[model samples]
Target: MPNKLVIYIHSGEPTQFSFAIVNGQNQLQNIHHHHDLLPQESFEEIIVIVPTEDILLTSVALPKMSRNRYQSALPFALEEQVIDDVEHLHFTAFDYQPDGQLPVAIVAHEKMAIWLQALDALSLKPTQMLPSVFALPYNEGQLQIIVESNILVRTGRWAGFASDRINFSQFLHALPVGSAPQEIEVLNFSDTSLAASQDSLFTYHEKFAASADFFPTLVQHALNSPGNLLQGPYAMKKTTLWRGDKLLKISLCLGVALFSLLFLYPTVSYFILKPKLTALNAGIKRIYQKQFPKSTAIVAPKLRLEEKLKKLAGGGDKGGLNQILSHLGQAMQTESNVKLKRFDFQNGQATIELTADSSEDFSTFTSALTNQGMLVKQQSANLVGTKINATIQVS
Candidate 1:
C-alpha cells in the first residue's frame, strides 16, 4: 500500500496552501496548516483540491452518442447557461444520473491554466484535480453544506455548487421547488454560526459540528470521490517500463537463441553433412583411380582429372562432344537425385537439360563440372513439383 498526499489550495490565494498525508489504510499521517512553502516529501499519489467557486457543477441532458461526439457537443449544450463563450471554458463530464442527465463540471480555460502553472512551479503533479465542494460528505436525500469563507454544497453524488455566504438565502430561493434537497445539514467551520432563515427552503434545516481538522477531513472525503478534472489534454502521462521482469524474460530468451546458434547448430550440422562430404571425396578418388590405374598417390583428384582431360583433348580449349558427354555423366554419378532430361549438341557446345531433387544438388553438379575445367553456362533453373528443372550449356 502507498501513501497519498492531498493539497488544498486556499480560495483567492494561490501562494497559501494546506496539505495532509494519508496512508494506504486511510489514516492521517501528518497535516500542515497554511504554508507558503511546498512540502518536499514524496508520495505515491498527490491529489489537488481547488476552490469550488472556480468550477460550475451542473447536469446537461444528452442523447446517446459516441464519446468524441459527446465531448464536442457538451459545450454547445450548456452554452446558454454560461455567460462566457463556449470555446473559453473547459468542460469535463461525469457519470449519468438515473434521470438520464449527464453531470458536467465547467471552468474557464484561463483558470485551469493558472492552477496548472502554479503546480508546475512547485514541481507538484497532482494525480487527481477536483473541485473542493465535492469534498463535503453527501447523504441520500440531504444537502451537505460547509460554511467557511464560502458556502460549499453537495446535493447529489455528482452535483454541487459554491456560493457566497451572504447570498446563501438567495441561492436557495433560486432553486426550483422539487429540485431542492429534502433536508439540509450544515457543518459550520466559520467563527460565527449560520444566520437563521425564515424561507420555506430551510424547513428541515439541521446543523452539525465541523471536523476538528477541517482541511485534512476535506482531503479524506475527496480520497473516495470519483470525478477528476484532469481529463483529455490535462490527463497525467503514464510511466513506461524500460527495465523490469518482462524485459528480463526477453533477454533470457535471446541468450538461449544465441547459445543454440553458437554451440548446438554446428554440432548438428557436422553430424548431418559429414557423410555426404566423405562420399563425394571417395567418388572423386574412384574416378581418379579408374583413369590412372598404374599411377598412385592421387594428391588432388579434381586437378589431376582436369589435367588428364586436357591431355586427352590435345591440350585444346574444347573437349569433343563424346568426351564432354562422358565427363558429364561421370561427374553426375555421385548426385543420385540429378537426371539428364535431354541434350542437343551444336558446334563445340553441349546444351543439356537436367532435373534434380533440390537447388542444392544442382549447385553441387554445376560446381563439380566447373572445377573439372568444363565451361558450364547455366541458362535457367525453375522449381516444379518438388524438383529443380535446369538447363546448362557446356563446352
Candidate 2:
C-alpha cells in the first residue's frame, strides 16, 4: 500500500526518462519528464524494463555459457555501451508478449534499491519498487490499458472471450502530442478503435474507469492467468530487492537440524551403548551369585548364568534345562536296551547312570553325542551283569 512511481526510459537513452507517481490505489498523483538534467541523487529506487530475447532460446543456443548469461546479456551489453550510466542500478528482465505471440524482453532498473540500502545502513526507511503493470487491475472484464511511450494497448474480454488480448501497437504511432505520450491512461478500451471487429460499433467514453480495486484485483488476475515463463530483467531485480531486513534462511535451517538432533540423541545412544550396558548388568549379577552361592537356588544360578552370557555376547534366546533333559531322554530312548536311571547337568557336563544290556550301547551313546559337537570326556563306564553306569563331561 505504498506510493509507487512508474518510470519509463526512452529506448536506447538510459538517462532521459519520464516518470508517473501513483498511490496504492493506482490513482495518478504526478507525471513528469526529465531529459537534460540528470538526477542529482537517486530517487527511492528505479525499475528498468529492458527488451531481450527468451531465456530458453538463449540457453538452447548458448549451451556453453552459464544459465545467467541468458538474463545478464542485455544489462551487460547496456552497461558497456552507455557512458555516465547509473552504475548501481538493480534489475531483472522478462520477455514482453504482445498479442500472445512472441515475447520481447523488458528489464527494470532500480536506483532506489541501492539508495535504500545505503539509507538502511544508516538506519533509515527505504522506498519500495513495484511492477508498473501490477498497478492495473487484472480482470478480463475490466480493461487492462497500458500507455507506454506513445503506445496504447487495451487487454480485456471481448464477446464471450475471457483473456488478455493485446491487438494494437498502432496507437503508438498515431499520437501527435509534444514528442510522444510518455504517460498513458489505463482504462476500458472496449469503446476504443482497438476493439475486436465484432465490437467495432462501440463508442469511446471518457468517463469509463476500472471496475475493481487495482492492486488486489490485478494480483488475483495474475495468479489465474497463464503467466509469462521468461520474466524480464526487472523481475530479477524485484527478487533481489531489499525488503528492509536480512533473510535468515540459513539460521532457520540450522534450527531445524538442532531440533532433529534433540530427537535423535537418545535413539543413537541406546543403539551404541546397548551391548556395554547388557555386559555391565551381567557382570553385576555374576558378582552377586559369587557372593551368595549357597543362598541362590541351583536352578536359578544356571538360569542367571545363561542370561549373563546371552546379554554379554548379544546372543539369541537359549532353551531351558528342561529342553536339554528332554533331548537327552530322546537320544537315550533310541536304544531299547539302555534303561536311563538318573541324569545330571553340572558345570557344562552331563552325567548318566543307565542299565544297558552290553558295553556296546554305551559306546553308541558316546559316538552320537560326539557327532553333535559335544566335547565328551568318559569319567567312568562299568558294564557288570548287564548294568552300565556312565559319567561324561560335555564342555
Candidate 3:
C-alpha cells in the first residue's frame, strides 16, 4: 500500500489492464474499474503486474563491481541460455542477493516496445513492472497454492507461475518427490479437483466472497513486493521528482510567465522613469527662474532663455545671456588648459571667474570672446597658489 497504484496487465491479443489504489495498511481503497483510459490521464508512480508468461525471471551470477558494469556483463552471461539475440532483450537485475546469484528479469525488446507504444498512447508509464504470480503468498517450509480455473503457486521470492488447468497438473507432477514442500495450503475459490483427489497432501481454506474478491490481495502484494521490471533504459526519467503529464504542466506555467514579462517590462519601466523625468524638468525651470526673475510664468526652459536673451539684446546687451554664454563656451571649447571656475550675468553684463595654466592662456580666451563681438573688461587678475585666477565683465 503506502499510497500507490497497482495495475495488472494480462497477456492477450489486445491485452487487458486492471488498476487499483491501495493505502498504507495494504487496504484497497479504490478501483477505477475501467480500461482504455484516455491519453491525458496519468499517475505519479505505478506498480505494474504483467502476466508471468510475458516476462522471464531467473538468476545470473555476477562479480562484485559497480551496478552499471555488472549490467554490461549480463547479456554475455545470459547469451547461451537465451535463444534470441542478447541485444534484442531487455535485462533488469535486482539488488544484492543473499544467494550467490543476482535476480534478473528478461523480456523481448519487440514485446516491450509494443507495450510501451500502447502506454504512450494512454500517457501511462509504470515505474515498477513485475510478473503477476508475485501476488501468490510465500511462507517458509509451506507451499501456498491457488488452483482455481487457473494455477498460481509461489515457490520462492520472485518465483511463481500462471498456467491453465491442464499444464498445471503436468508441472505439479513433474516436481521431484523428495523435494516436495513439508506443508501445503490451498486456497479454494472454485472446484478443486486436483487438491481434493489428494486431500492427504493439501489443507483447504474457506471460500471468500467471490473469486474476483481475491484481486485486491493480488494488487496489495504488488504494492509491497519488489522485482520491478524498470532498469537501465526502461527506467522512468525523473524531472524534479515529477513525471508524465505533471512535467508538461510545469513547462507550460514557465512559458506563460516569460510571455507576460514581454509586455509587463515596458509598462513597469515607463511608470518608474516618468517621475525622474519630471524631477529633471523641475530643476531646469528653477535655474531659468534664477536667470530671469521678472518672468513668473514657466513653460519651456530652452525657449524661455532664448526669449529673455532677445529682450536684452533689444536693450543693447550683446545678443543676450544665451549669446554671451555661447561665445564663452565656444572660446573655452578649444582651450583645454583654461578652466572656468564660476560665471554670473545681470543687467546686460556678464562677470566671468576662471583659472588658467598661464597668463597667455588667459589672454587667448579674452581675445576669442572679443572676436565674437562681446566687449570684455578685466576687473581683477592674479595668480592663485598653483594656477592663474582672473575675473572679467562682458556686455
Winning candidate number (lDDT) = 1
Query: Each prediction's Cα RMSD?
Result: 10.1, 15.8, 12.0
| TM-score for each of the candidates | 0.59, 0.35, 0.54
lDDT of 3 by residue, 1-395 (tens): 23667777655632566778766666777776565442233345577777677677777888777889988989999998788999999988877677768877788988777767766666676778777677767675455676555667776675656667667656665565754564566665565455555535535443433567666767766766877777888887774545657878889998999989988999999999999999998888788789867778776778877876677656434647777888888999857789888878777688888899988888898999999988999999888766789999987
| TM match of model 3 to true structure | 0.54
* Top candidate (TM-score): 1
In Å, residue 14's CA in model 1 sits off its true spot by 2.6
Report the Cα lDDT for candidate 1. 0.81
In candidate 2, position 99 carries an lDDT of 42
Candidate 3: 10-residue stretch with minimal lDDT = 35-44
Candidate 2 deviant stretches above 4 angstroms: 1-5, 10-16, 20-32, 35-45, 48-139, 142-151, 157-200, 206-249, 252-292, 295-395
Ranking by lDDT: 1, 3, 2
Q: Per-residue lDDT of 152-263 in model 1, one digit per residue for the tens?
A: 8777788878888678777777776766765566777767666464356455444545555678669879889888999877888653333466678899999999998999
lDDT of 2: 0.44
